[model samples]
Target: MKLFLTCPKGLELLLEEELHQLGVEDTKQTVAGVQCHGDLEDAYRICLWSRLANRVLMPVYQGDAETTEDLYDAVQQVSWLDHIRSEGTLLIDFTGQTRAINNTHFGALKVKDAIVDQIRDLTGARPSVDKVAPDLRINVRMHRGKVTVAIDLSGDSLHRRAYRLQAGQAPMKENLAAAVLLRSGWPARIADFDLLLDPMCGSGTLLIEAAMMAADIAPGLQRKRYGFSRWTGHQKGIWDELVAEANGRKAKGLSQLEISLVGRDEDKSVLRSARQNAERAGVAEFIDFAACRVEDLEREQLPEGVGLLVTNPPYGERLGETQQLMFLYRHLGDKLKEQFAGWTAAIFTSNPDLCKVMGMRADKQYKLFNGALESRLFVYPISERRPEQTVREEEDVVPLSDGAQMFANRLLKNRKQLAKWVKNEQIECYRLYDADMPEYSVAIDMYGDEVHVQEYAAPKKIDPVKTFSRLQEIMTAIPVALEIPANKVILKQRKKQQGSNQYEKQSETHRFKEVNEYGCRLLVNLHDYLDTGLFLDHRPIRYRIQQEAAGKDVLNLFSYTGTASVHAAKGGAKSTTSIDMSATYLNWAKRNLDLNGFSQGAHQQIQEDCLKWLRMQRTPAFDLIFMDPPTFSNSKRMEGVLDVQRDHVDMVDAAMRLLRKEGVLYFSNNYRRFKIDHDALSDYVVEDITFSTLDPDFKRNNRIHSCFKITHKA
Candidate 1:
């Protein structure tokens, strides 16, 4: 049978590769989804082992559809009685394009009507529609006037997996959380590492997923029911055989495994939930759950080798307070710096500002989406700083601008060959665009006929002669690799004024331009922000959006220069809206959209706070919404700081208000300490969409961003 595997936007390739390694045949990519041919046993095996797929679907039939009658006729022609009995309960899910069948519920109603009509004609009775606990679930997808119907082989989303017996405030889905651990290189055979720890282990999802992986336990083993079980074609013997094989493969020598796994949370209820989840996954014996604040966590007493610590902390979005969380993160960083010597630590958070409080530099970083929150996973390899390192006061460094023009002239002359090379080779994008101090140290972008550049001034510690020489060497080497002549490169130094305040000088000196690359136009300006023009970490997520975006309306909230929007529009979003408070960013977004030929009436650029705009919008506005808010932002225009950990409930509520009933909202944030206010959001159905967004490039950093897909409860 042919099967479809659905995952979050970025992980299709990963899922495809996993399927191939498992020996599943005919694996291929389809938009944001994947397709493979497998028997009932293969389907079950995928459910148990696939770390990337969200659910497994078995296609039953496909036919043409031009109207509601055509849809009903096509659905009715399927042998419904063969798959679903009259005594069972049924549910229908609809997706994709259909003119008369646009609304999911209306489409579901038509399918249900057809199924009942067909069943009644044959059996004299029909199954009832049960949205929850349906014995058999059918999915109908229409693409370009063609309809394909499938049976949802997995009952609940495969992410449920039955391992989680209890949940904390904002628990991650088992599959997604597991994918993070796998992507981060956790649970591997590493030597000389202390242990794997989640400092803010709400519900222990991360810890449980880690423990399961460490034990080689199939995630789906705990699930008791599947949609296929209710279908007539399900082979009990095959399923039993698969389960036995899975059990036989389960790790028996866990004690022989080198690493220990630990999770700590401040909430007592959350600790209880974590323990309960661990027990459900049958790994309670292997995982240690403790109730403690991040500040109180100490390095375990182990042998000489250092351990690895990875954590997802609060983003202060939903909790209504950020100052305390910021302070906690700062203290957490201080503790790591002072205590966890020789240990490698990865911090997952959507909040860059909070990350700065740690006052430590990460050795590696990756972009990930936690739910719909855009976040970063910063890996700080902690060990003793080189003893030769010494603190120097700002007063110690010589000023390069004290003698400016002579230095600038010399730098320009040295880079003359490099500039010509840049133009000759058409080096579209390169770092260190300019290094004219007294003026700026800028990065240059060569986009065919356009030259986009960002300017930066020299750092206080660097000497003019040394800085210019370094810039010349870098510029020369980069263009040569691109086969460009040095005369084509344009080098410019940023100007600095005497007695200017540090903040003013830094803010004024930096500038950047947008460029188009790989079918998407991006605004790649690294000078003004810590991140340059592109986020290589979210490379997968953008790929997913582009792949799945054809003919869909995309809503991008907190759309920083609309990178995702650019990808989505280029991927074929019928319309796109980029919302943010900064006009500067909106203008940049417009430039990117224009570069992609999507900056016209079909795309809307809104310069407003997303929260405010969401509150003002009505329902059924967009098909897909991508929201990645800052961990903490206190704009002068807003009444308070926008905190993801604290404001998530409200943010979700607002975003959902604009979503079409069947539409999905991809909400993400970088707040490592973020906890979902599940109680506050009991009405909407939420799934942790993080795992499907994990890209291989982000293996070093876990919890890049916590993402969730939410829709109104059916």
Candidate 2:
């Protein structure tokens, strides 16, 4: 028998390969579908076991239909009584093309009328139309005046898989989720890791799927029906035998398998749904489900082996603001750093900004599509080491002084001509002042492209409006001077304090603002000297974080306006906690939280030093946590320079104290050459989370931030 399998766009190859692997012969791939020749049993097996196919269609015939009469005649020519009995119910589905019969319903009606009329004329009885529960389901596809008719072999969408009796918010389709896992190289015979984890487990699709694969269980075993069973050619005895054989092949002693599989979510309802789904899939015994916040996942002992952690986190488009997502990614990085050492991690996400917040380098990545959204999967290999081993030290890779030198050299080459032109053209905001002194020559301002100026003078006095006006004027003329198109130019002015007391004016500088871009409203903010406006270097990290957050709770510490929180929430974190010290930043975090629709009780905002908060908290807390602190800071409210390197032990200990028994913490610091004091916390386990943090944009700087995961000793 010849059969055609349908799937979403770009997945035809995957399904075709799957069909071949399932023993179907002569498989061919096509746009939006795949074709293969097989026996009725093969069709049944494919319908049951193929993971990537959406629907199986048995093509009955194909012909050209330039008019409605042609379509009706073609439909009547088929032996309708062969597939549909006069007493049975029938339903017709039509997809139109460039034919004269353009209306889908009208075309379907014509086909239905022809079939019924043929049946009545031949047998003196007519089948009833049952749209909801039709005994015979026929599909008609018309494209470019060519019509192909087929019978639907699978009744419902293959994604149902009959495994999920419940679902989490923004749950992923089973087929897509399985495809991601398979693409990630899962189900190794000798698994490198003794565990699989989905921190944002949602309704536990990823976790349940992982567990089933680990146990070598077929996903279709739970499904009770297929469209083929209703076909005239269906052999009950062959299907029964196939089922028996599949049952005989059922994995024995899965309960005895040493691997640990777990999922965590903040929403109890979601967790409940996940539990139900797992039960229906018959893999309930193999998974551990928890209703917990992302900040509370702690590391549990495994059977003396490494494990793999995979997740599909929320993206800002579905869940939260960009800053909030960034905050979630940051905390996810922190949690991975704090826990799950000697583990491999893979995350699938669509948001670039959220990937930046993870603060880890991904060893591997793949461009993929999560439905309509283009996404990426980032793979991070966790290492057993001191947390500092994971930190990316800017000084070691490229010293700040060297960076300053490079900046100066570039400006010097362009400054003379620029300054001369600025003076000649009477360009305002020219290099009236320049930090040319070696100790202070760090700032450069340009008016027009011709005004290649450098400042050598210190800040004795300055004009704000006058400087801005000059810069704006230069911005307007630079494109013209450079012969660049107006649309190609981006002009922005640097904001500064207006008065001495302005520094004392505490306002929420990191509050979320909705900006229209790419046909959607995106939340962004500008505050802090650390480029709160954007962390262009962390784009990869945000993408990775979203991939991992599908059904997990996320914790973002040192959340810094909660950009990571936003990413995690968007990536589908059940809950998130964002912690920082500044009230202004906390308010900013709130704004980000609100913008992402995650400002509900599930997510939390705290204004406190993350270390202190960790110390005051209980253990077995977070599944994923992100901690990225300033390299140096001296606030009157706190102590001296807040060095991440010098204070990593206390910080790790505090975070671990709040981690769940099997959770992860991504501890990171921007301090260049920052080293971990391992001996100070010899009782804990640490793993490097640095290799996955590298971003292509940060090519000049290797160590964007050093990060590590620490967990309790197994």
Candidate 3:
């Protein structure tokens, strides 16, 4: 007889190999399943021992199904009395459809009609539909005008091992958990007495599955129900003998089992659920459950031996959640290196970018699925060399050139000079070095412990090879001078960006670092783009807005990441509106606001061309408005190109129209040669407050940006 065993997608090859190991040698891999030649005894053994299959199906009929009538006839070809009695309950699981049967519901209804009609005609009785528990569960699959009717021997999916009585958030199915263990090489590791640990083991799914596989316990041993339990053709004697054999094997396997299994989660409730689940699976004595954080994991948790640490941490789907979870992934990697050196680690996550900050190199990576979400499993062999030791080894060999030593001396002097002021102002992010020397034209800024270095574009007369050498010196000097590791330095080249080029992503590494700026928490990515989310030149201006924003309606135009708007909202603004042209920045702004306890209601973000939006306003509604248009932009998303130098008067006039009689509008830009057209805007009084808005870090480059204060003339 031929049997079809179904599993999740991407596991077809594994499932085929598993069937071969079970003595069913003739197997063919197909989409999400495997087809094999097996007798009744083999089928029974698979239903008990197979860990990756979702269902075991025995084909009963095969014929053409070009229409609904043809499908009914194909199902009727099966000998109904041999499989199920006329008075028994049945359920039909229909998949696929034809032109005549346009949907699965209608196809299933037609199949049910055929089965009941045949049974009633023969014995004057018919089975009623039972969705929960059925005496006969039929599966009908139609593909390309052909139908294959089969009896489902496994009622529920094999993932439903009847051990997980309660589940935590985003739980992994049992079959997938089993596959994760198998792929991580847990079976081989167990034979060597290597320990197994899951740091984020919610509900103990991975732990219980590993225990079952190690103890020779059948995955279906705890399951009290199956589709074949009430089928008329079920061979009771064969199934009973298999069960007895499995029980004996399990007893022997348990007596010899000596490997350690440990699970840890931060949530106490989930840990309780995990313990209960382990007990129900009859593996509670073999595993240890604890409520501990990954960052707190120590070397004392296991004996001194090479082991495996496997876990599926939360991979958030939203931008805000992803930013917050980056720290968690980093901590997990840090702990693995610090405490579990010489061991192997496997991390399963949906977001691959999070793996970049793991601080270790992966030996192997495999793509799999956690239900519908595509995910990756990365395996790493933790090296015994510590991080500090590696850093010291690197420093001893890398000698700085004369120019780099001079630049490093300047960095030390600047940091010492700003130390007092930074402490007095409670500033966590500030510029440590600008182009102090003519030879090196790079700007270095410190955001907490991380450093961002931007090298200015060299002149056409400069040699490319010489410029590259200078950049290398800067990279070496910054880390050494700052006493920070080389990985903490994020380097990028500064060049003129046209239109939306500045907003476009330079890389896909979504590593975000959180910094505190005057009691407000903000996220900045130094490597993903040309500009970090927060602008250091406009720091004082944002603080000015925050100081005067109490109970005022505020507006921020071209609000990239909404740093200014966040400051305004934190100042107790009555309402805030942030408008930008890119949905990416708008979502970024939303995340910034949400990070500071501001949500949907009084805070609004609109994705539109700021100039176009300003013209659409017909009424005076805002008391304070800040406009920081780009110097030049010809983005395709906008109605027209925006040249701040040429169009500043008109843009300011449109924005001022929405300001009340006593309201004030702050207009700023970075066009160094931009001069205000005084004659064009005689209705409002404008003051150039550029010098007042300049902070100490930007005082060296006085023309970095221009600021103004405009109000209705009295």
C-alpha lDDT score of every prediction, in listed order: 0.71, 0.67, 0.87
Q: What is the lDDT of candidate 2?
A: 0.67
Cα lDDT of model 3 by residue, 1-714, tens digit: 999999988788889989989999999999889999989999888999999999999999988889877887888898899999989999999999778887898888999999999999999999999999999899999999999999999988778889899989899988888888888887866655468899899999999999999898999988898889999999999999999998999899889878889899989999999999999998999998988977678878665677888999988763224433655787788788767877889898888877766778999988888888888889998888767776865674667789889889999999898889898999989998889897888899998899988778787687644665676678779888999988788777666766766666756779888988887899999889878899998999999999989999999999999999999999999999999988888998899999999977999999999888988898999999999999999999899899998999999999999998988899999988889988898889999999999878888889989999999999
TM-score of 3: 0.64
Q: Runs in model 1 with CA error above 4 Å?
A: 189-192, 251-258, 300-304, 360-364, 388-714
In model 2, which range of ten residues has the least summed lDDT?
A: 493-502
Considering lDDT, which of the candidate structures 2 and 3 is the better prediction for this target? 3
Best by lDDT: 3
Task: Provide the TM-score for each candidate, comma-separated.
Answer: 0.53, 0.55, 0.64
lDDT of 2 by residue, 503-602 (tens): 2322234443453211112354322222333343454455456667667777888776676777777788788888877886677667766765675698
RMSD for each model, in Å, please?
Answer: 24.0, 23.8, 9.1
Write down the lDDT that model 1 would get: 0.71
Supply candidate 3's per-residue lDDT for 224. Answer: 90
Candidate 3 residue-wise lDDT at 43: 89
Ranking by TM-score: 3, 2, 1
**Tens digit of per-residue lDDT, candidate 1, span 260-355:** 787888888778877887887788887778788775777654234567777778776732124335556777887887777778887877776678
